[model samples]
Target chain A: MDIEVIKRYLPLFSKAFLLTVKIGWLGIALAFVLGILCAFTLYYKLPVLSTIVRFYVELFRNTPLLVQLFFIYYGLPSIGIRISAQLCGTLGLGLLGGSYMAESIRSGLEAVPAIQSESAKSLGMTKWQAFRYIIAPQAFNISVPGLMANVIFLLKETSVFSAISLMDLMFTAKDLIGLHYNTTESLFLLVLFYVLMLLPVSFAGSLIEKKVRFGMYGD
Target chain B: MEEILKVEHLHKSFENLTVLEDVSLTVNKGEVVVIVGPSGCGKSTFLRCINGLEDIQDGRVILDGQTINPPLQKGDNYRQRIGMVFQSYELFPHKTILGNIMLAPIKVQKRDKNEVRAEAEQLLEKVGLSSKKDNYPRQLSGGQKQRVAIVRALIMHPEILLFDEVTAALDPEMVREVLDVILELAKQQRTMLIVTHEMAFARAIADRIVFMDGGSIIEVSEPERFFTEPRTERAKRFLKTFEY
Candidate 1:
């Protein structure tokens, strides 16, 4: 609550905020790529790979992100596989978010009626062409809200990055409180930074949803 | 007359339930053959089988002297020769009406974009939908959507067009607009195999009427004789429902 303390902590908090945003977006991007690939595998029911994707989705979705981070950061080095703390935080968040994204994308793919593909095929389109032009666009429009939710969820999950020794917002806030006993100011800044990170994503998601909906059926 | 498409002994079933049993029909070039029957009689299934959309247990669909293999490949060439319009329209919701019509020609056929767009616009005009060229499917009425579906198929210039109850989903007022498009196509000597419940339209449009019951053709006769004298007892019963 002290103005002096608030000003003093701003630079540290800003640095931490940048790190959190950087790692969060990188993880979410990885998640999207993995999710899209996994969803396509599951949708096509591809041999061997689909089963592996299914197992991966279940594994990541069922477990906690904190435990995932721990395993990636602490447990891998035990087997002589060394990964930096930042990479661990990003990978852990990505792998976990990927599963949710896969489910969201899969549901979107399914929601597109069978008739759409059938119509495309009847027009002499190959399975790939039909999926690319007819199915994928509609599925992507359907998945926007769910994907945006995952984005926000994964960003909020960056709080656990502190456990892996990443210099994210939560880690900086906790470090300040332990040093200066300025818990109120630290927590306030933490909340402020998190909102600043998530609000635009939430706003952008709705905008995309509206645009997709409008594109689907004009006014 | 030269035969454009011939279906021989088509048999289709979903698991234990038989949908089309030993259905066979031949369409000559420039012929308008209409198939009519009671609900669940496999009229739609028969069209789907001919289009290679449904897997047939036993039969052959020969188009342009080539037998169509169901599992032929990812994008079989036979399907390009057989255009189909569904009962639900099935126009791509994300695309404009012009996009819907131009897609197969440009993408699958690898035709020139400007030429396909011009042909699409002409087809849309023929169907009285040129004004809706830039409109999405959801913005249009069911009848308008069906017209777009027809134009989408017509733009392909398939050797044979199959329409499965295209007017079955439209409002009473809307049905006429769609049926009129098909009638105009028939006048142009486009070979089409149609399934419909509109008896009057069928009588007017069909060169030959195929009456089906219980997954098999009960009668195939000239429309003039079929409507007035209906040879089969089932046909007699079916035509009676439309009497009132």
Candidate 2:
């Protein structure tokens, strides 16, 4: 356990940390938007579109994230669609997170009672207007806790991005251990790095849960 | 007098169970019709049909002389002009009382905000809920919620109002508050069709009493006669327990 070896790898860890943050941030934003769209299609029972969305969710949710990332990073090139490893990692995380988000949002939509929809209709709101105003706001509140949990899980899943040569936090740690031949110390710090990445997400998720509860159910 | 609503041979059934059968009635402009019957007699279903909330299987309903059979064509059709209040006080729980009242006028009618707000304030006062304007539905008592619902319905300035046992959800003490508001509306001669089992309420303010049973109106008469004579045997039996 050489202290100097860990100290020398600090700058590499910082660069890897930035890549990890980039992957998580971009993946979550894209996943959240895609998830909401998928949830809307599923909730409304749109013809054809709903079926395709269900298939996409099933495919991503059932398979292993590591395997999914490998397929995207390795398999795509054989099919003549070459892309950067970083882009592949992002797309993999987005698809994985989007699937879980769809389920969370669907549960949220189901939580709204039939009476609310009728009341909206009675007010002469069009179908889309009713969904946008009444159903969407309420559903967002209902699903916040679950979606926030999904976000934390997504952050951990970003670790799989290391296998695809993205130089994310885990990959940087693995390279340092290889160069320095110190598995115990490097692995311990890697675990700490991951814990640090997820701490803010978990904290922020709870804050959102609190805000959603107040907005929806009040004090 | 021009009629406000006319139902001819209205029949509705869900799956295999028939709810309403061959129901025909006419409501005159400025008239208040009170529909009373035993549970499962389809009184609420009848009210829902008039507002186009439920589709009738076999009959035509003419509202203010226009047929309500076909789904209304988009825009320029303000079937919302006919407002309804429910037994559940189905006020929008997420909104303040003022928000509930302003929703229809602003969104449906596209009325100016200040004008709608002033009108909402006046309606809330009329329903005796002016002080609770900022409270959410969950924050109010059942009686207060129903009062806001009444104000929400009336703010649309609907040509006719339908009350479906609005006081049914309230405690005995709170029922008087809701009935008093309805009585005030009756005093103003707002066209309304109310469904209730409160005989004294039906007798006190209703212009006409319609006794229904098994999805048919067996007797329709002036309040005094319907309560006193009750020509049909069913009406007579039904009135026996409700004797004041």
Candidate 3:
């Protein structure tokens, strides 16, 4: 409960906070792009790749994300593939985020009626062109709300990275508490950091969803 | 008259139930043919097959002297010449009315944007929607949306225009507005195949009236002859449903 000890650990926590932001942002960007591609594959019912993607989604979505991370970082090095801890965490989070985001996008695809796709095709659009110009933009708008929720969950899941020694905010918080024995102060700061990260995303997502709904329903 | 579209022995079945059986028809240049039948008579399916929207189990649909079904994939260049409008007015809800009209012209025909925009403006004006260029489909009424859909189809400068029950979903007051735009297109000597329940509209604008029943055309005649002299018993029975 020493105030001096808490103050000494502050700089380290801030550094870890910045790292957390970098990892989460990078992980989310990679995951969203990958997830959109995965979503399109499933939406179009592409030949063999659709089946393969389904398996990937189920495997990642069903298991605990922590286990997936541990298996990647700790389990894989036991074999021959040795990835950096940061890369492992990022990849693990991306894969996890991609699965949920893909499903979010898939649900958006379902919301669009079959007639719309047919309309695009009859207008002489190639399948890929129809998807790119017509389907994808609408689907992205429809899925934004669900995607934001997934991202918020992803931000929290970044905590699991602490277990792998990536030195994220949560990891630094626990380490500071272990050293200073100031549990209340350390945990409170950790909570505050998470809220700061999440509020903007939540607010921005809601605003976007409102715009999409307005575009779809007119008012 | 020059033949613009030819369908030869087209047959389609969905899970063993025949939707269109050995259907064959021809449309001449600048001709407007109205197909009238009861619901589920395969009129819409027949129209869809011509554009490669519905697959036919047998035979081919030749448009502008090219087989469109299993389109010459050599380059898929033929799609640039044909366009379709749906009954639901499937305007891309995400895009503005201007975007809807400009899509096929810019994307398929690869027309210059400035030129396409000018052409789209004219098209919007033709459809009586010049003021709605920036509005989304969701902002328009059913009639306004259908007009935009018609303009979207026309901007492609298609050799043939297919109207699939264009006014079925409109309010009684909105029906005339859509038919007015379509009737105007008809006057332009566009090759048009309209599937409609508006017996009176058919009576007015159709140069030829085709009566379809059980997936086959039972009678094809001038609208005057069609109203006065229906050949098949089914056509006679179908005619009785409408008090024309």
Candidate 4:
């Protein structure tokens, strides 16, 4: 343990960790809302809105997250809509991940038979009620595992913020290494930090998957 | 007898393929009409069309003088009024049997939960599956699931019930239990339109039998005459194939 190194890096690590948590969860929350609304609009094929969403999905899905971030962070400023690195990173990640999230949710909803909606309708449920009560619940249960995996992927993708100068954990660790040339310790600590951050989400995801499987199909 | 349902000159097509063409039928209140036909004769499509699941190119389905057409959003109450049991059971697998039975009434109809729950338990008892109330659809046999589906429909107190080859997917042993439930429903004299391959069950419970072939109604007659005389050659051939 280098006493000077530990004392010096601790403040940086703490600041970086708080930023990571804030940016990561905010990105996911935004993605989750976009995923739900856009998935539904895609499902119903709402005329021009659906077409725009389809193009958005394709653009985001096909391009790499780093390019999207660069395009947003650097390219946008040239167009006069200057954005902070933190905003660019969070928005880029949220929008990019939202495409995959929409796909996962749409696939889940589709897995429920059209007859389920018909049955609900035949029971006097309006289309909205049928979707909300009958189809959505089943879709959610079926989709949890895929969506959970999407979340974990998105969590890891938050590391791309390092490319822009957002002081996320990755950026902090890299900066520490750059300053002190302590590659092994700095890199290993970053890995440990990521594992600690990500393990809980994956573990909770697996447990939910089990409960959903049991509830959906029974023993 | 008051006519509960009247479908006139119904036409349905999917893309370029015609399913039901100029199909017409009338059902009186408390009457049970069983439709028998070969596979892909548009029997199931007709049932689906009645519930607005299929878009009809032209036709009028008058239930109590209210016309039903595709995109059934306007006549939302028609769903509660006319219940349908599909061949696949279509039970909400995520819900318990009791939940499936009470969902429409309590949630869709916005009825009191305690009252609906009591009625649902009674109906579950009528189906002889009170013990299975808390069980999920996956835990039930095909026959039991179909029976639960029927109870789910019956809970709505529908004016007319449509069965679309409901027993077709069940095993032979499973078929009888479901047929027995239909028989009981017929004995209760709730208006029903049944599409079935079980000629014996159709003959036993139907007030009249409708024979269809190639998307057209070939014959409609009393059960005795339908079983014996069958007016058209197609009906005769259809009955001949069923004899074995």
Question: What are the Cα lDDT values of the candidates?
Answer: 0.92, 0.85, 0.87, 0.89
Measured by DockQ, the strongest candidate is 1
> Per-residue CA lDDT of candidate 1, range B1-244, in tens?
9998888998999999999888888999999999999999999989888888888999888887888845455545678788899999999998888889989999999999999998988888888988999888998999999999999998888999999999989999999999999999999999999999999999999999999999999999999999999898999999999887
Candidate 2 residue B151 C-alpha distance from true site, Å: 1.0
Q: Model 3, B117: alpha-carbon shift in Å?
A: 2.0
TM-score of chain B of 4: 0.97
Model 2: lDDT of residue B202: 93
Q: Which stretches of candidate 3 lie over 4 Å from their true place?
A: A1-7, A46-48, A207-214, A217-219
TM-scores of all models?
Answer: 0.94, 0.91, 0.93, 0.94
Question: What TM-score does chain A reach in every model?
Answer: 0.96, 0.93, 0.90, 0.94
What's the count of clashing pairs in each model shown?
0, 0, 0, 0
Q: What is the DockQ of each candidate?
A: 0.75, 0.45, 0.63, 0.62
Deviating ranges (above 4 Å) for candidate 4: A1-8, B70-76
Q: Which prediction has more favorable TM-score, 2 or 3? A: 3
- Best-to-worst order by DockQ is 1, 3, 4, 2
lDDT of 3: 0.87
Residue B3 Cα positional deviation in candidate 3, in Å, after optimal superposition: 1.5
lDDT of 3 by residue, A1-219 (tens): 556755776787778878888888888887898798898899879999999999999999999889999999999988999998889888998999999989999989878887888888878888788888888778778887789899999988999899899999889888877886788778877887888888998889878778876666665
- Expressed as tens digits, the lDDT of each residue in A1-219 for candidate 2 is 677867877677878888998988799888898898999899889999999999999999999999999898899999999999888888999999999999999989989887676666666666666677777777888898889889988988988888898899889888877887788778877887888899988888878777657734775
Output the TM-score of candidate 4: 0.94
Q: What C-alpha RMSD separates each model from the true structure? A: 2.0, 2.6, 2.3, 2.0
Docking band of candidate 1: medium
